[model samples]
Target: MRHAHKRCEDDGNWFVHPVTNKAWSNYTTCVDKDDLNFRHKINKLYISGYSVSVIALTISLAIFCYFRSLKCTRITIHKNLFISFIINNVLWIVWYTTVIRYPAVLFSNKPACQILHVLVHYFLLSNYMWMFCEGLYLHTLLVRAFVAEDKTMKWFYILGWGCPTVVIITYASVRSSYPEETILTPDSHQTRKAVRATLILIPLLGLHYIIIPFRPEPGSPEEVVYEPISAAAASFQGLCVSLLFCYFNGEVVALLKKKWNQVFTSWKN
Candidate 1:
């Protein structure tokens, strides 16, 4: 009998697993095998909306950052948030346009694949880390009632750009120790989900609830009036809670179900 799993010779085609011999299709390709016009339309709408929002946000941030006169200790946190938002927007565009649209390019060559993998993963992780930094800085200013006498621009560079760069370098070093192809299989997807939960999501949530609120000193009346840390804290808390639910209840549960199904199928066969 012919092998159940077969690898496609062409990178553009689907690949079959050696163990299960199951053919896996590339969903990233725009080719529509199924008739899902409504779904496709919705996706298009989402992409367009996201692109417009990103562009608007990027331009607004750029304008703000360009005006050095607007720089101040309090505004430094906003600047960091702007930088993070810009990077996140760029990453989103690249991810959707390149990885999602033309995934075959990812597996074209080892160097190309590695570069793409690093850029995609690094930017994505950095985006979240910078967001956490933004929250942390705001919390420090507001709740802890800490004020930096140093230049705001320098502080912005350190927290906004420096921290994310450090995180990216650290994550890249760890990932490079065990490099793999760009393909995202079901198993690899699960692993990525777990890693994100443990590394990014959990820590962020912890910072939002446990760390930021229970800092050295609660906000003074002046700090509360000027900084609005409580408002920011509430927003962070809501975001973290949403992410926790999505990962644990939604994504994790779905991945587990798929894994169990695969195991059951193998046993039956």
Candidate 2:
């Protein structure tokens, strides 16, 4: 949904808030009663979705760790990706509960809140970078079957972790130079659908960018229909990835079934 701004007065001045008696940007259209109720529902949905994702990702990580026989370069990359997703999901949950819910914290410009903001985005970038590592590894494996896995993993590690650190550090440095008043805070009425739209969709379609051209205009009726779907997809992305890559993996399933059969046999004896 698009934010509605108050029209300028005839004298080319901003309108005054009746209650504050000060010149302020009127944004009432963006946060009406119905929108608040919708935001409440979306908040609950995000918590529930992220909680499920955390559980799923944690289980996947455990599976990867416990199965020594399943260990490989690919599983290593998967483990790192799972860790990134887990941290990102937790950060989002914390963001919703603390920073997002409390306008005072944002207005106060607390260092902790700003740090959390950086950390949340750091892990988000890590998630995508690790995914890139996965693709690169697979391509190298196919094209140059004799390539040394151990040697390449070092480079992958740098790409996945080091690159994001460099980028974020540069970003934070540049951002900090800007004046405090120039910093834009998130509006309560503005959902993060666009920012998170590609989270799970990437796994389903490696080219999630295809949908970018079709994005509905902000504040259009189409946006009302799109926001919930985008949010839900982004929130549950970790769960979807864990399910597709870990729980449903052929080797993992076979190993688990074999373990169950052995346990059943021992119990029978």
Candidate 3:
């Protein structure tokens, strides 16, 4: 969905609601009506954005996988980045088509949905972790060219895949303690978003800020207002990474051009 709150314990403001539920309920129409509109918006904007991202990401992945010469440490990490986005997009698509579209399943709260819920965020955290790895690799290679690439990649793997589990476990543990309807179960949207932002920022300077999700009223159905920060951050991940790591990369572009020319020359022959 275009809604950022879907994946997290809750990205639904997705943790950045400027208005309280008491105020929200005052002006908003029927709860079901608002939720319906939200669902429609999510399916339209989120699905379309993610679809385009998936196509672009596939092309980016192919560029790296097909070219043996371009398989350097940096580019390998780029492939991992693309792979993370790919998995995230695919799982989200599965969520939309399978669980969400079928209202009965969503409200039924099937075990599969819970698994999907966990998986969706897991891969998302994985994406951030790998991006952190990307920055780390860059810094290491630039400052110390003598370091062994394999060792560096090994460490990257452990951190990128391992770290998110801690967050997810903490999230699930905290969420489990509360009743299902409680808003606190899912951490605040901005809190989760800031965590991802912090990962990208931590290496730059020593500055750190811990922002958590802004929880809504305990039982207010209308508390789930969508926020652009979490929504845009989560939905547009594939597009951002593709542009940053693959589409905009000098090496990837050159390789793609070389492949196109080779294909064109073969066609002419």
Candidate 4:
């Protein structure tokens, strides 16, 4: 495959590989192939990370939902957030196993494929919105500790779930107006601060390159050398949320201790 890009001499369009002198007629083939390979590697890592989060979130949800004593406004919010994580992670796994592995399916414009694409992104955005809800809930608790409002969760449900729909619908509407596969100009891509931040800072583990087989997309002018950084970050949701909201939870620890003591006492009897 590496030598498939060797110069044809009939057309000198492709930039020659310095070391191998490989230059194929359709340079974008190698680039797209590399892109596909990169996503494949990220899928493995996503599965591992997302699987851990699903386990943690499952435990967290079970503990909170099963125990009546753990019921509180904050815990309610946490449960909802964990639900979002569950959905987001599952959707991402579905995406990687199906769409990412078979990107041409996206080009097919199949109703199911298009719906899956929308759903994966919708839940992804919903996950972020739920995180915002967590932050907002925490802030509300701190700033308005005395102000007891029973309808707080109601409004939160609206903000967390409702707002993401508006944004996604607007996105779909705008995108539907445009042609398929519209590549962003260099300047446009540069202005994407969120994307830039994810690409630069999120993959701190530096594991993307290690997992991905070396398949350079040198022919692609728009493809970054480390594009997998953004993809990995985008796909690897829920793990941090699970760790923060469940594993390190003092309340959950106390509940576990209480339950353990109850079981031990029964056994002694």
Q: Highest TM-score: which candidate?
A: 2
Compute each candidate's TM-score over C-alphas. Answer: 0.48, 0.78, 0.65, 0.67
Better of 1 and 3 by lDDT: 3
User: lDDT of all the models against the reference?
Assistant: 0.50, 0.77, 0.67, 0.65
Q: What is candidate 1's local distance difference test score?
A: 0.50
Candidate 3 vs. true structure, TM-score:
0.65
Per-residue lDDT of model 4, residues 1-269, tens digit only: 54334354556465664434555254455556765675567668777767777777788788888789878876787788888878878877777778777756655666687677677777777776776676665555444545454677888888878888898888777866773642012243433532443343234223343645655565564345454554545444455555555666666788888899999999999
Which residue runs does candidate 1 get wrong by more than 4 Å? 1-32, 35-46, 66-69, 149-156, 181-269
Candidate 1 lDDT, 1-269, residue by residue in tens: 21334347677666774434567654435534342453344345435544554565555455445556546543454445545545555555565566555645654535655666666666555556555655554444434433453644466566556666777788768777865522012254644644544465445534544544444342344543323343344323323432343223453356557768998999999
Q: Rank the candidates by lDDT, best first.
A: 2, 3, 4, 1
Over 156-180, each residue of candidate 3 has an lDDT whose tens digit, in order, gives 7777777888888887777667636
lDDT of 4 at 88: 79
- Number of backbone-clashing residue pairs for each candidate, in the order shown: 1, 0, 11, 1
Model 3 — which ten-residue stretch has the worst lDDT? 203-212
Off by over 4 Å in 2: 1-31, 179-219
Candidate with top lDDT is 2
Worst 10-residue stretch by lDDT in candidate 4?
A: 182-191
Model 4 clashing-pair count: 1
